[model samples]
Structures are given as structure tokens and as C-alpha cells.
Target: MNEGYRKDIIRYLSVLNNLGGCHIDTINGFLQKPSYIGASPPVSLFPSSDGKSIGDALYQLSIVLERMTDNEFDDTTFYHSKQLKSPLGPEEVRRLNEISLSAKVTQDYMNTIGRVFQSYQLFELLSSLEEQHITLISKALTSIFPMDQSITNDISTSKQKNYQGIIEKIKQLFSRTKIELFLHLREEIEESQKNPHKSSISQATILDTLDIKSSEYYLASALRQLLSTDENSLTTLVNELRKIQPLQITQLSLLPFKDFYQILDLQANFIQMANTYQFFKEDSNSQFNISTASEIKMPSTPEIKIVDQPPDKAIYKRNVKPAPSVSFQGDSKDLDGNYYVSVALLRCNDFSEEPTFLNGASKPTKITNGKIVTFKKLKVMVTSHQQGETLFCFRFDLRRYSSDPETNPNDFEIVSSVHSSPISILSHSTQLKSTAIADLPKVTEVFPLSGPSTGGTRICLLGSNFADTPAIRLKFGNVEIQPEFFSGGTLVCNAPEHPPGTVQIKVSNCQNQWSVTSATFTFEDTNTINPSSNISSDALSNILPESVFGLDFSKTFDTNFIIKGLETASSTLPSSNGAHRNYSKQY
Candidate 1:
């Protein structure tokens, strides 16, 4: 027997041995094989053996098989097969044949049971039927069974009749039950349509008829329908159900506007209204106005003069007030009759001069009484002079009345209003000096130009520009290393440990001045070898030869040498050893 098949037989045997109240022949029939008197414990438990031992083993095997078949092992062919070639009586043989036939029938029936359940469509349909109808169908079908057999003769004929009867009964029952279910469903649907509030009842009925669990899709669909009808009560009920079954809520397809657009529109309108009200209130408080003005000019000759001149007291004033005279003047008189007059004049000097210049000037050449007189044409001539010579000047004088002439000047007190020039003091001063060269230091060299892998190695940087305390930065390749500045020239930096190779170090100071240096360093595996490990050439040479030239006895040894003394060694040993000893003694 194949080893694999033998193992399968062993598992079957174990199952049979553990089963209770089963028969030997029935178990053999389940195995689809005759019981052999000696099968070497099914070849899995033991090897093949002769008839005498086989007979005893078969008897024990039968006991195990008996428990497997539930004691239904009266099938004679399975038991009689243990004798192998022995001829059986006619009556015994006939009985064995009948048992074989019945065993085949039982196996066929068991096989059909599994197939029946595998028909998924049938199971689904049966599941959809009303519970009462299902129970009635089962009872009616079961009734024609084993019950009819007990009361009838000729077992084969009775079984056939019962089977046919139950099948017919199930068909008739399903037909009647379906008709009733359809009528009920129709009425429920009709009522639901009349009153959408009762739609839940109709929905439940349809789901029950289809035998579908109240899944998320189903519940959500029902909830959505209720919401569509504007049934607040139904909607609330559905929402409450969703809380209990969160999955149903997740499955629901929310109405697009209900949760999104409508809420957005409402917020937008509220914001717009608030803005509109703000604009309206602002406009009410502040009114707008528009006005226009016309431009007019008076000639320098004064179209009219309103001065009171006393007869016989002529007021003589200075002629030619100054070059570039200011023609326009404004004065405002307070209730006290004190005049506050301000004058603006354009300057005509190559450089500006102080107002004090006006205090002491040569008296006017032409004087009328105590007032100065100017030719009207002369005033016009000054206004049209060359660009640098003609200018407009402004002046302001405050005139106040005093009770005593000695206490305050009755003459106008001239006040000078000069515009100060806008210039920065820092720009005007030329004494400020530039940075001295003594402040800058020079750089020399960087040591251990490389960094540590774990980073943190203090390296000495040699150079100048090292101030009292200068910040240093180390650069390896394009990557820069941040260093701790310990002193002016000395920097404590952790060398960035990099891959084993030559690296460049750039040392810099607080002034951003840097110097580049190169260093070659090897990265050693600290775990496997000491960082300071060194090997001489001689030591290496000696170790290499010993390891490479070593011989292995295991590879050279033969089976004959392993099992016995060497035959070849015996023939050559004596003469060769004698000759070698004599030759050595002579030397």
C-alpha cells in the first residue's frame, strides 16, 4: 500500500476506534472496503503479516470498526471476507450479498444529504418562507418517513412510497403558502401607498418575505424615503434607529442640499445682510458735498490802497524793500484790533541769508516824508528778473498795543520764521573712522581635519583672526560642522564621524573667516577590532602560512583505514625505517 494511503487509513481507524455504538460492517462500508483478517494494522500501524496473526488483528479491528458504524455491522460480507479463500454456505453467502446491497444504499443516501444542503437556491427559498409554513412543511415531509416504514411490510417498497409522498406534500404546501404570502404583501403595500406614514410596515414586510437581514443599505434606504415624504415623526424614528445601528447611518446617501448647499446659502445671506446694514448706517452719518472756486489775481501796483495819509504829515518808507520782494501778504485782525500779519517771500541770494540782514541795510535813496517810495515799474522789473536773482520771500510780524511805550516796542516786533534744513547728523560728520586692521585676525591650520561618526571630538584649530572668543564652524565636503568656540584661536568641536575616507576641515571664526585643511583617517570597527590595533609584516606572514597550509585528516581518510589497519603500511614500514636509521647513524 502507498504510505500516504496507509496514513489516511490510520486516521480513519483512529476515528472508528473512538466512535461509540458503531458496527464493524457499517464502518467497513464507510471506508468503502472489505474487512481483511490481517492487513498489517492497515500498514500505517505495522507491516504486513501472515494469516494467523492477521486473524487476531482483524478481530480487534472489527471491534474498533463496530463502534464506528454505531453497531450496524450486521452486514455479513464485510465480516465473512476475513476468511479470504474459504467457501461459505449458500445461505450465509446469500445473506452477505443482501447486506452488501443495503450498505450501498445507505452510503448513497448519506452522500445525497450533503448535496441537498449545497443547493444554495433551495436553502434561500426555504429561508424566505414563513416560519409557520416552514415548520408545517418539515412536519408533513418527516411524517411520511420512518413512521410509514414501521407500519408497512417490504421495507424497500415502503421507503420508495414514503419518499414520493413527502416530496409531493412539500410541493403542495409551498404552492398554497406562497399564494397566501403574496396576498398579504399586496395588501400591506396598498396600505403603505395610501399612507406614507405606514411605509415602514410595508418595507419590513417585504424584507421579511425576502429573508434579508436589516442591513445598513436597507435601513438607510428606508430612512431616506421617510425623509423625502417630509414625515418628521418617521424621520426622527429612523434617526434614532441610526444611532443604535451606526453602520446604517454610514450607508445612507444624504440629500445633497440638506447637509451642504442650503446651510452654506443661509450663512451667506446672513453675512450679506449684516454688511448691507453696516453700509446703510455709515452713509446716514456722513453726507457728501461738492463745491467749486474761481481764481483771481491782483497787480503788484495794488489796484486800490486804503491807507489814511495825514495832510502835511507825509509817511516816507524805504525804497526797494529788497531784491526779489514778496508781493502777496495776509493779515488777520482780532477783536482787540491787534494785527497778526504773515509774509512769504522767495529768496534771490546765491546762498540763503539770516533775517537779521534786514535789520541793518543802507537807508532807501528815495524817501517821501518818513515812508520809502519805489517806482511802480521797478517792482515789476524785479519780479521778471533772472532765475537765480529773483525769488519770493515770506515774513510774519505780530503787532500788539502797550499801555506804556517804554515797556513794549510800539514799533513792529519782527519775528523770523525760517525752515530748518533736513540733514542727518551722522552723514554730516566726517570724523567717524573705519574698522582698524588690528581688529581682524588670521587663520593657520585645522587638525584631525575629519569628524567622528557619532560626532563629538574636540579639535585644535590654529590660525589668527582669533578674537578673545571666536565662534568656529567645521565643514567636511559640502556639509558644515557646528563647533563650540572655546577661545580666540582654539575651538572645541566634535568631528562629525563620517564614512572611512579622507575628509576636509574648514575652520571659521565669528567674523566668518575660514581656512581649509585636509586629514586622512581610518574608521575602524571598534566592536570587532581595537581602534589602536597594529600588525607587523612578520607576524602577518607567519599567521597566513599556518592557516592556509593546514591539513585535514577527515578529507584524506578512506573507509578501509577507518574499518581496519592499513594494509599498504605493513609492507613498506620495516625496510624503509631500517635504512633511514643506518643512514642517520652514519651521518
Candidate 2:
């Protein structure tokens, strides 16, 4: 009986795996196979047939299965069923009988099957059973699993918080321009809804009449409210309206009231309407009125003062100062071909402060031809100061009027000249005298000379004194040759046209007395000799170097012997005349 109980439990588990979710077809396919076997218990070594004892154990199994299915068990139901004198109680017997009589369990047996299904992960089993059945099995498993109410509430709160955050961000973006308009439009809409005839029909009403969505409808409605009465505020509102129109007007037919003139007319109408509804007014003529609620004063206009001055006759006066000549070193071009003059004024000993005209003094500096002369005003006060015997240094950039006199009405001409003030040589006695010698021009060590034997050898004469110096004269032994000076301390020259021997290449600057000499260079004439002719006989005494004629010349010492042998061999050979005679005779 114990073995049978285990077998029954195994069969119940197997059946649950098949019957769960929408896995009916897959379960049927697996069960129809020959190899497929239903769950059976291991053979029980000890068997009991005592109905009361067996029924007690069966009753327990029944209660366990019921608990697995419903996820809860009733102790009262179990107790009442256990009193019956049967092999199994009413519920337990019925479940066992169903398993025994059928090859497969039907949907009616689902309650018992659910008990076993709940014991194991039915979803995992169903996943392997069929692909299509996964979602159904997942739903079933979710339904069976116990949920935490607190966790669910927390998730819901988190979602609500995220939604609120998104809403706040959207409101912030809209509030920049749209919100104010929306509020005004909403007020108008509310008023329109309350009293249709009393409220002025806005262009926003046309947008609403087109049955636009809330997002699209609000922008136009809001903009119309912003420009309702104030025409001066229309400029700012028009710019804001441009941004909204493109975003909101996906369909062109929605906003029928979009002409500029129509908008202006609407604004004018709103102004007129607002002016007509003014409830309070100031009574300037009356001292007091009892019926008047309150009298408000309008803001007065600000007064502007204007002064008139008689035009003076044109008088030419010169307040000119002599300027020294200056040489500008760089590219300078006139913007309009007008003569520009720049002068560098020297600072003098008496010049305490930089030159500046006194307050209200007009010193019109004019340039006639290419020279600048200042025009004297009636009450001009000019003062000169010297600092340690030098006046303040000033650079005056003046433009000439004669060059393009028609264009310049100021009657000032820029002197096409620049000036430098006298160099203020301080008194020698007061100036700090340095005992140390002034920085002498640096003389660099000459680089080692290098070049070909064909006379012109370029040698880099490296040193500081070489800079700005015209020619660098290099001494090759006693011969002095001036090298072409190039930028980077390089000197190119013929190497004194020396013989094919080692010569000392020396370098000296044209400006300096000191000379730099290089170590002797053993010059070899590359075109002079055949290199093979120079090979010593001692080096090739035994094994002869191969001759161009492929002969062992070292071994063949006797030339006369070779000549005699060639002569004897020629005697044995047919002569050219003899061969010609034989050919003639044969013919």
C-alpha cells in the first residue's frame, strides 16, 4: 500500500506537468508515443490490506494533495472523511479511482491536478512541453504565486512619482510663453461658456471650432489672449506666436484667422472695446464729486529742454606745432587712399603730464596737403611741460583733407608724414654708469668643414656674430675665400681649388679677426684612377685574380711558349688562300 501511494503521487505529478496551461496538444503528443510511460511507484516490499490503517494513510495523502492544489487545507473536512471504514476516504478514494480508471486525466480532474502542479514549478515544466504554451503557463504561475500588497503599493507610488515629475517638467517648458496665454484663453473660454454673448469671440474660438486637440488648440488660443488689448505688446506676442504656429498648425485649415492685417484689426478692436469699458476717470475740472467712487490721476509727460545757438562764420586758425620725420617700417595702406600721418612726439624734461587740451577748449588739428595743423578755438588754454628736459611723447595719427577733400567736410588734412621727437639724452652725470662692459656680439664656434673636391664646398660657419654680417671669409691654409652667407649661419664657397691632398679648411667672418679651422680633409680625386690597377701583386701572389679574358694568367707565365704553340697550331690548320683555291678547283 505504501509503494502504491508513492506511485499514485508520481502519477499525479506527471499528470500535472501535462495538464497545466494550454499544453494539452503537447501533452497528448507525448503520451501517444510508445516509449512514454505513466508514473508508477516502486514495488512495495510490505503490503497492508487493513482498511482502517490504509485509509488513515490515504486520508493524509488526500489532505496533502488538496493542500497542494488549493494552497490551503480544512482540518474539519479531513477529520470527517477519515471516519469512513474504507481503504481510502471519500475524497481520497475518488481521486485514486479517477487515476485508476482512465489512461489520461480529463479537465474534471483539474482540481486534483492543480494540487500536484502547485507542488512543483509548473511553468518551468510547461516551458519544455510547448513553445506556444509559455505565456499561458506564465500567467497561471503568476496567479498561483502569493503577492505582497505593500510591494505593489510601492511600485504604484513610484510610477505615480515618475509621471508627476514628467508633468512638472512639461509645465516648466510650457510656462515660459504658453502658460500665461493659456490662462488668459482659459479665462476667456470659461467666460464664453458662462455668458456667450457678453464675451468677445476670439480667433482662438475659430481654432476650437475646428475641433483641434488640446495640445494644438491651446497655443493659438493662448497667443490670442496675450495680444487681446495692448497693441504695443504685439511685437513680443507676434514673435511668440511664430514659434507656436509651426509647432501647433500641422494642418493649415485649422487657423483661418492668420493674416497680419486681420490680427492688427483684431488688436484694434480689442483696444476700442477695452477703452469703451473704462469704469473710472479723472475729473480735472471739478473740485470734488460725491457720486464718483475715486479719482485717479494720469501720468504726466516728461518735459525736454532745447537750447538754440547762432552759427559762427567759418574762421581758419592754425595751432600748428612742428613735427619731426619718422620712418615707418612695415606694410601700410590707406583705407580710402586718404593721406595718413603718424608722428611720435618726444617726452621732454618739463613735460610732467601727457599733452591734453584743457576742458571746453577746441583744438581742431587739420592736415593741409600732408601736414597736420591744429585749429585754434577762441578760449583755448595750451600748456607745455618738460620731464627731465623732455616733453611728453605723443603719436598723432592724422588724416589729410586735400587727397579726398570732397569726402571730408571736417576741413582737416592728414600729413603724409610721420615724426619722431628728439631723443631726450639724459645728463651723463645723473645717469647710472655701469662698470661692466656692454654685451659684445656673440662669436660662435665654426662647424667642421665638409664638401666635395670640386672646389665649391659649403661649410656652416656656426656663431652669433655671423648674423647680419654680409660675408664670411674662410681661410683654406693661406688662401682667403669669401663664402656666400645664407640665413641659418651657413657659408657656401669654393674650397680654395686645392690639389688632390689633405687640406685644412678654416673659416673666419669678414667682420671678425678670429678664425675657425677644421681638421685636415684627405681629398681624393674620384675620376683619376682605375681601382683594379692599384691592387698589390703581393695580395694575389698564389691564387691569381680572374682576368677579364678568363685566362689563368698567373699560371701561364711564358708568353713566347704560348706564341710558338699558336704558330705550330696555325701551320697544321688550312690557310684562307688554300681553302679558297680548293673551293675554286672543286667548282
State, as a TM-score between 0 and 1, how close model 2 is to the true structure: 0.17
What's the residue-level lDDT of 404 in candidate 2? Answer: 46
Clashes of each: 45, 31
lDDT tens digits by residue: candidate 2, 4-111: 222234323333322323333222211211112333332120123234332232332333342232212222223212321133357764544333222122222333
- Shift of residue 149 alpha carbon in model 1, Å: 99
Q: Which sections of candidate 2 miss by over 4 Å? A: 1-393, 398-412, 415-587
Worst 10 residues of 1 by lDDT: 578-587
> How much is the lDDT of residue 205 in candidate 1?
55
All candidates: CA RMSD (Å)? 51.5, 47.9
**Winning model by lDDT:** 2
